[model samples]
Target: MWVVTGYAEVSTALTDRRLCKDSARLRAIIDRATAARLDGSRVAETVATDMLNSDPPEHTRLRKLVVKGFSARRIERLRPLVQQITDDLLDAMVARAADGTVDFVDAFAFPLPLTVICELLGIPRADQRSFRAWSTVIVGSSSRDDLRRTTTALGGYLAQMMSAKRSAPGDDLLSDLVEASDTDDRLSPLELVSMACLLLIAGHETTMNLLGSALLALLRHPDQFAKLRTRPELLDAAVEETLRYNSPAPVTTWRYAAEPMTIGGSPIATNDIVLLALGAANHDERFPDPDAFDIERQSTGHLSFGHGIHFCLGAALARMEAQVALGRLIERFPDIALAVPADELRWRPSTIMHGLAALPVRLGR
Candidate 1:
């Protein structure tokens, strides 16, 4: 595996057609590495067939079919809904802060985005809690048994949900997808299930981590936090800076070299599994004092959401979510502060995601 860390090189690799995201090719490379022909489980294989694992025109088609559900207009319409959710969650947090402390991760960060995505997908409120456990294992676990178990569970749940949507369609994203599949065959059954899984996982996981990491960064840097509170207009810049400083998605999903190429003057052979370190590239010499957490800095061009064609489809939604969640949190809880020492916090164990395991904050401080 080749790891590309330089900003310029990683940026180049993101768009270069020579690097591909075809899952079959990736599996072939893995098979060669392990010296065995390994067939993934049905659930695993179906999940891997999402747009995130395909190349154009397959990726292009899949993205087109799903992008309408997350259009700018749709996301904009969701702001009021997002604000309501944030306010409700904050009310609960205030109620729970009788002891003056609350785990922001549980109280606000995780549920805010999760609720939005779940509602958009028409998932019942009762079933929303179970997703946290399934998502944690799907993204963070290293054991094959753990992964298989979690994916099977998630996939089975989605299959049942899609089946229900087919019989009685609802005014939800999943129903629209089901209609598309059943009407024109634009989406196969496996593809529909895989896409739903992708939307459920990717829709909330990255945004959840972004909220946690953003709060952690602000709390750790009092000056920046104060600046945000005083000059509320800087909320967007603050979110962008947090994305560069501690990107939720630290590294991108795997990319394979379609042909021999040189990135950062290093030779990458065909079929080499390449990992682009978004976190590292964001801290590279491209920006002045890249290590400094300056909300006022020109933090544009950061590859936290990635670049080129494969850039995150939920970028607009995630940005709106962070801005709304953080802006309201600071406005409401002016006395919020870290409950424990900054160094005492621990990040979840995941190579691809950067997020705090827990963010204990004194809401009344």
Candidate 2:
């Protein structure tokens, strides 16, 4: 495995066609060593065909099928809805804070984005609970059995959902995806299911972490937090700085070497998995005083959303969601502080994402 941490090298490797997204090559490597039964499995079908694991033509087609729904204009229109959701969650947090403490992660951070994504995907609000376990395992599976079991279940649920969407199409994005699969014939059933899983899971989880981490960053830097409270225009910078300072997705998903290639003077053999450390790259010296959490810092060139064609599909939505959530949070709980010592905070153990397990806070009583 080749790990690229330098900003320049990570950026270069992102656009390099030599580094492929095909999971089969990497799976072959694992299968050879462990004798894992991956071939002809439900997990294999979903992982092998997802847009995140395919090269051009396939990726291009798959991405296009759903890109229109996430367009800047489309996402921007959700601002009012996002603000409403943030306000509702904050109201609940304030009510809970009557006792002088509340778990921000559960009350606000987790639910805000989760609600938005579920509504966007046309998933029933009641059924959203099933995703927590499945998504956690898919992103941070401890073993092959865990991965296989969770993926099989997730794939099955998505298949069932897509079937219902076909019968009763709606204004939601999943309905749009179903139309593309049935009428336009642009997406296969498996591809549709995989896309739903990818969009629904990736859509909310990363943003949830961003909300949690961004809030944690502010609480740690009260000066910066106060500065933002006084200067509303700095909200964008605060959000950007938070993403650069403490990235939500710590690393880009695995990219396999399609052929022999040299990245940042380091030679890589074909089929080696290339992991780009986004958090490390974001703090590279290329950006002056990278460690400082200066919201006013100009030129925020972070790979938190990645670079090249595979750049996050929901970047605009995530940005909008964070901007709204953070601004509303400060407005709602002006004196919010950590309920426990900062050192006591725990982080979720996932290589691909960096997020606190819970953000306990004293939303001023």
Candidate 3:
């Protein structure tokens, strides 16, 4: 296994066709490593069929079908809903801060995106909480039993949801996907459930981390926070900088070397599992004073959302959610400050995600 950390090398690895993402090839490697077939797990089998695990033609078809349902217009139309959700969460946060402190992650960061994504997917509000638990386990848990249990539950839930949509479709992404499944290039039942699971997990998990990390970044950099409060136009730039500085999805998923190739002069052999460190690449020497958190910096070309054919499909949605959520929080609480010392902050223990476990803050002066 090789970890590519240099900016140029990570960028190259992302676009290079030699780095394969095909699920069968990846499963073969995993099976070899574990000396057992992974097919015994039903949840694993269902989840493995997503676009993220496929190559060119298969990936292209899956992405095309999903893109139709997750259009730019669809995301843009949600701005009002995003704003409403942010405002409501802020109101709740303010109310809960009666003791002068509140866990922002619990009150705002987590629920805001969860609500939006659930609503977008046409998931009933009652079931949204279950997703939070399932997503947390799937992304953060180290226990295989726990992971299998949670995924099995989530897979079953999605199967039921898809069935409901089939009988009585709604004007939601899932229903759109159900309609797509009925077409000529239709998604198989496994693919349908897998795609929904991918969207459901990726949709909120990344954005939730983004919200928490962005606010944490601002709280640490008082000057930048103050500057954004006064110059609201920098909201977008602040979100971008936070992404580059503390990437929510810190590393790309595992990619296999289909053929021997050199990345930044280091030779990678066939079948080598490669992990591109997006967080490291974003902070590489390519960016002037990369360690410094400068909202005004030209933070373009960062691998925060990745590169090539696998760049985040939800980049626009994540950006919008962050911009709305962070912008509103800053606006509503002019004197918001960290409730504890900056050094006391703790991050979630996961290589795939960089996010705070909690963000306690004082909402008022």
Highest TM-score scorer = 1
Query: In angstroms, how far off is 192's CA in candidate 1?
Result: 0.8
- Cα deviation of 148, candidate 3, in Å: 1.1
lDDT of each: 0.90, 0.86, 0.88
lDDT of 2 by residue, 142-233 (tens): 57778888888888888999999999999999999998888889887788888898898889899989999888888899999899889989
The TM-score of candidate 3 is 0.97
Off by over 4 Å in 1: 35-39
lDDT of 1 by residue, 1-365 (tens): 88999999999889998999988888888889896565665767766888999999999989988889999999999999999999999999988975889999988998999999988898988898999998898789457777888888898899999999999999899999999888898998888989999999899999999999998888888899888889999999999999999989999999998999988878989898999999999999999999999999999999999998889999999999999999889988887998999999999988887788999999874
Error of 2 at 197 (Å): 0.3
- Tell me the tens digit of each residue's lDDT in model 3 across 239-323: 9999999999999888999988888778888898999999999999999999999999999898999899999998999999999
Error of 1 at 159 (Å): 0.5
Angstrom error at residue 338, model 1: 0.8
Estimate TM-scores for all models.
0.98, 0.96, 0.97
lDDT for 274 in candidate 3 is 92
Model 1 TM-score on a 0 to 1 scale: 0.98
List runs of model 3 lying over 4 Å from the truth.
Answer: 35-40
Q: Candidates sorted by lDDT, descending order? A: 1, 3, 2
